[model samples]
Target: MDGSSTTTALVKAARAGDGDAMDRLYRRFAPVVHGILLSRVQAADADDLTQDVFETALQRLHELREDAAFPGWISRIARRAALDAWRRRAPFTGEIPEAASPADSVESHRDAEQALAAIRSLPEAYRETLVLRLVEGLTGPEIAERTGLTPGSVRVNLHRGMAQLRERLGLREHER
Candidate 1:
């Protein structure tokens, strides 16, 4: 009748080894995972890693703590896989070189290495949440749903992550 129930039924079917159920589950959640990878990884690599996340989720679904918790469980795996991808991008860490930029203009020459360096410097938990929202472009609720955390936990991570990002960027927090 409703999407929630439909999702539950689909997950149940998938858990039972139904090929169609697995297909339906993939159709429902693939875009969300793809979008997250697209935001957090290079476009060239996102598609491949997105596939990996789903494959990992499918294999690990039986380990999920709850049926309704599928989104969060898969999200956490995606986050970990994305983080590993980030770490593997370069041999050393410093300012993301200008080469990673798409253009050569002085202004357009934003350094990806630098930005990622900043993001990586954050506490692990906060960094993951920030990337999901800012880089992955997932909403707080979407993140909560995927990560198996509460909406409030996602919000707290966002708030704290922003504060940390601001500090890392050398800006003083503005008191409103």
Candidate 2:
């Protein structure tokens, strides 16, 4: 079966209380959820918020109207959860705390942080699409499928978002 069919089946099974199916659905969609949260929330909070999104989705599974809509449904939940978290947090003070892992060099961590900050400064649509594509490694078609956006819209968003991102990062087209 195709991926969408499999996702539909998994959603159906999950709604029926099948633990394995729920786990499979989580595995399949967590990156999308995380990427969504990452685009709206601080990096440190995104992981926790991803778990909250899945938990909320699991609890509300019965309310989901269509099995095949799970991707879009869960994404909306992620976005809402992120917005709620953003609302609850204190205002940004132009300083993001350093969160360097032992394996990451300071320079790499700083670069990644700067790029993420630039992304967050973008408009909401571009931020989410860019995070899903660039950070989560989802392709345009996958993003379109998961987010229920038209393929053409996803393409346009990616193209325009990348251009804006390049400008923000001070990189010429040839540099990329």
Best by lDDT: 2
Off by over 4 Å in 1: 1-6, 16-47, 63-65, 79-106, 109-112, 173-176
The whole-model lDDT of each prediction reads 0.71, 0.87
List, in order, the clash count of every candidate structure. Answer: 6, 0
Taking the tens digit of each residue's C-alpha lDDT, what string does model 1 give over 64-108?
867887776776777688779988895333433445554666554
Q: Write the per-residue lDDT of candidate 2 for residues 18-118, one digit (tens) a residue.
A: 99999998988898999999888877788899999999999999999999888889999999998898899974443446643657778877788788888
Q: For model 2, which pairs clash? A: none
Instruction: State in Å the error of residue 128, model 2.
Output: 1.0
Name the lDDT value of residue 54 in candidate 2. 90
Residue 109, candidate 1: alpha-carbon lDDT: 42
**Against the correct fold, how does model 2 do in TM-score?**
0.91
